[model samples]
Target: MADMPDRTGPVDPPGPLARLLHEALTRLPADRASAGLLLAVSGGPDSLALLLAAAELRAAGRLAQVHVATVDHALRPESAAEAIEVACISNALGLSHTVLKWRRDGPLAGNLPAEARAARYALLAREARRVGAGALLTAHHLDDQTETHLLAKARGAAGAAGAALAAMRPWRDLEPGLVLVRPFLSVRKAALVEAVRGQGIAAVDDPSNRDLRFARARLRAELSCQPDQAQLLQALDDAQAQRACEDAALAERIERLTRVGHLSISPLGEFELGRSEPVDVSILSRAVTAVGGGAYPSPRGALESLVHRVRNESDGTATLGGAQVTWSKTSLHLRREYGRNGPPDLVWPAGASQACFDARFDVEAGAEPIARLVPYGRWGRGPLGHRTLPIGVNEAGAIVAAHPALRWKQGETPPALAVCSRVGWRLCADLAIEARSVLTGRPQNAANRGEPVGKGVADTYIRGQVEAACVARREVARAHFQDG
Candidate 1:
């Protein structure tokens, strides 16, 4: 906590900027909106403006609850002090604020900005969960979106050009329960600065914004002199619309495959794809991320090469992003790669009832304390039924817990302990979100004036599809476990 400033009532008016905030907040479900919101205030002009506008909305009775969090990356000498400044400002507005510090282990290697960004999100997400907030809001404005679009083109990923052009989504699932929303993507940075200044608040300016060493900073410098900002924005809007259609097409195919049993995702994070038609490379890339436990999909070139081999009917195994793909005569299997770079053996700490391992499986502990959870390969892969599923063993190396599908009758797991695959949940949840996005015709650029066609019908159809997929998933899970 920090000292509060002298102020009262609403920090600012519910003007156009505040209306933008209200519109973004409305995108969330009523239940989640009621749950509260965690704002990622970095003390910069954009975030500071966001904080002020949200405070106004809260005072105006338009917002239920709002919380503020700042990430102290500790990258610069003044980072800690800047976080305190944010806290002081938040307190003046009569809002709760938190400062999350990024703990580094040893030296950081490879892509410092990207690593810092990831760490910031992880810390913010943990804090959001602790505070019972369902949505994490960031102050990414139109200028930021433009910069992202330019950077995507600079990356030269031609194979994924369509996706790259889409830039960033307006709203996306950060994790299972938490949703990340950027309400200012349609707003301009200058308007935010003016709003903050109107409140008589001085925002913390980081020199890194103009540091030419970073590509974004350099792009920003160049764009300041460019005359065609609107043109770039229009390009981004066009690309986003195209990408939305492409995603809808992909979701449609995925639904068809799951409905017909040509594609099934086991609760143990294994993907079984029966060879009937040519498999989409995008689907394989998605599977690689889901089963391999990678934070993102594999690179397009790698995925394209793998897809080529699979299409040519190669009868062998290929590894990408710590996932192993085996092609058989009639089907293809994707599982976590064993030897190296795979999930390490983990112990279920005493007193903790639940845990997540390898970013894939969610585990629940029973009353009986287990020794360690190791890959099935270490405990004689044959008996547990599936080669990909992990098992918990006692001190004597006897299987005490395993996924319901992989349990062996010889040493059946107790009723209390359970292992559920996040991969299954993640895939189904993603499909539902995509289906809704496509059906509702939600554009990435929220400021677009285009009207959504058949929104009600689209919503109903997508909801039904989602329910059907879940039902089909349950049936497949039951059959797979029983057969195993």
Candidate 2:
């Protein structure tokens, strides 16, 4: 049996949960694993358990610096108090704590949970960057994964998609530098409850978990009634295995295409397919989302329809997921479609040196303070034509320069701008990096430059592979515990 650390002056050896956390942390890239971590503790049992385990590890010199952040969404009257309680606990444990408040400027109408979640992550990301943390930790457990699978299924996920939704990745990039890590996804909620009890802390039991007002809560209620936990997990395992197979095959295809020069992405963020090249739906979906500036890939049915049109039509243009798709006998082109509204102009704060524009590029305003960043198209045309990218305009509306991605003959030197691909790089990060390197003549270093690293667009496949491996290991561990 693993030794549990005492809460007194002298600490004992780290416990089993701490060991699990160590394992998870070690799985990250060495630099990130050793760097400081920001723990998102909500005072809930799972998060509290994570905090306790991490604190023990830190005290034993098994972990690096740890910071705690409790987000007060201000949805309930008790939320602020709960955040304070978490802060007090963190202080007693000898860790720095920050309470980030989510201030809602307007009334949010649809999907309150989803909205809150987005806000929470944004706040956490801001805090993490400010504190120089490499990664943020969230205590999502096995029960959460099961609930997610059930929710996805209820939303009409089926076939390969259903398989892909079976589980969550242990670690994923929240942005270029900051990663969101779930160390306890494989741990059961019951184990976490026990761990918290062992720590002699009273964890918050959020009424929302049993409120039944939310979809996940309602699903949790149903699952708890006749909890055939083993059967559900077994089904998830099966799905995860299927997802791994799909991802491997997809990765192979992407590698082959890149090797053969059939696939390439330009510095202007255009995804191009060579003439006579076969159209892979998965690859096309990623290109469309990346170029279209959409958060997710285009819907499957609509994407398939677009593919059919691309194959049949000799030369035509179509819009899907905010990206314009133009096909010709020679090649197919996909780029961001700026309609009547065009891209939103970025108003640079007086003293700020950096700002993300269109969620697509990281812009650095040099010595000259940028008054406003307008679409390059607004000032007629640059090297890439009108609206190809953004440009800096002064108060008098004179074009100062183009985006770092483009060249301007009449304008001064552009500010430093680097592409942050709108399309997620989880699936084909390597390919995306290579394509960017080949097209832009830049070194292939995604880590330092804030560029994404991964396969590219085979997210479903890669996610499946990662989740399956994680699930398999946890299952083996569970069986071992039972046998012992």
Candidate 3:
């Protein structure tokens, strides 16, 4: 445990900055008031200001316990010392602090900036989970958002441009439970610097921010000389509003036509073809990605070709994003390509809490080791009477434990297996919620009325699998006792 700071007296007042932070905090989900927050501080001016504002909120009882963490990417020689300095500042504010390190060895895959950003988020997420914090806060502000939009425009990155225009949301789910929050999206960088200076906190400036080799740094330099700052900001705001409307409309169309499960199926006929090509292509891309379990959607060129075939041709087969797409006269069918090499075997060690096999099924173990999990393809057969790709723990080709035991006898018990439908479930749920929002004229995030949509199904399925595993373990114990 890190050393706890003294909670003696009130610190310096944050003045107007405190008010701004409170307003942003109020916009978060209602449940956030109870769920604690984790601040990702880099000892920079922006993050230091965020920490101070959050501390004020904590003092006023507007927020629950607040914790701070600094990541040492280990890329710079002075990063370790800088992390220690952040700890001291956190201590001054009477907040618990943690130092997380990036332990990746060897050179990165050439994209240093992108890799570093990903690594930073991964570290922050792990720390958020460790501290049981529901929300992770960063200090990204309006200037950063503007820079992002301009950079995307310069590079002709339409997708990145749209994302930058949308800017950072008040809250986004980083994972299943952890939400990332950026309260300073509307605040200016100079305002944050002033706030940190008012608190007598000195921040370290990372030299990388000004490096001309990076696109963002070059954009930042150009912005200093650009006279149309207000116009640029206004354009960004308008773009964000338009993007929101487009997203809601697209989500509605997707919900109407797509069904996500073991197979992401959608019916395409005159009704779908009647819509704009962009909408049709977007929905199909999401479907293919969901079914294929790919990290990203297929390229636009491939998706456009597939869309054209689906509209014109009667029957055909195509592969995109590791998914086999087969279309008939009326509908398109997408499923994982089992012929392609699946994920490697998973070792379910004894007493392991849970294991995932091939990223498809959730595997729970019994009291003993149960069995070493292998792909069903190795045995040249499906498990539990289902043709879907099933996983089985085998001993020399004899099946012992199988997930989704669809064909188990009435008197026989088998190790539990449940479809890991998180990806598919989220896809469907997001579309459904967005569609409802568009229909009801409500905000997309507000459509669920406070509760997370689709969480219940995923949670219920996993809980049922865990409970079944417990019963199996108990049954095995009872049988052993009877034999003894």
Clashing pairs in 1: none
Which runs of model 1 end up more than 4 angstroms from their true locations?
A: 1-13, 28-34, 274-276, 308-318, 327-331, 344-355, 363-419, 428-484
Q: Count the backbone clashes (under 3 Å) in each candidate.
A: 0, 11, 0
The models' CA-based lDDT, in order, is 0.68, 0.69, 0.59
The digit string of per-residue lDDT tens for model 1 on 1-484 reads 3343444555455666566666555544322233467899999989998887777777776666678999999989999999999988888788899999887867999988899999899788777766667778899976788889889888874355665676766666666556687767766677678767766777888998899988999999998787566577667776766665666677777777776778877655788899898868878888888788787778888999998899896588889987889997789998887754237777664444555677777677765567877776665545322655666778887777665665455655444347656665445433443333222223222211222211222333432232223223323333332212
**Per-residue CA lDDT of candidate 3, range 1-484, in tens?**
2343443445445445555555444444332322557899999999988887787766665566679999899989999999999998888777899998887767678778989888898778767656667668898876797887776676565554353355555455554345677766666687788767655677888999999998888888988787557677766665666555555666556655432311232211001222222327776776667556566667778989888988888778887876677776755666566664454666663344455454444445544444566655564555311433445555554556655534545776565554333344334332223232222222322211233211232223221122122223323323332212
RMSD, candidate 2, Å: 5.4
Model 2 CA deviation exceeding 4 Å by range = 1-13, 29-34, 275-277, 312-315, 345-354, 365-374, 379-388, 392-402, 405-465, 477-484
The TM-score that candidate 3 achieves is 0.71
Which ten contiguous residues of candidate 2 have the minimum total lDDT? 451-460
Please, what are the lDDT tens digits per residue for candidate 2 over residues 356-425? Answer: 6665555666665578877776655554324757677778876665656665556455555433443334
The 10 consecutive residues of candidate 1 with the worst lDDT sum are 446-455
Worst 10 residues of 3 by lDDT: 265-274
Q: Spell out the clash pairs found in candidate 3.
A: none
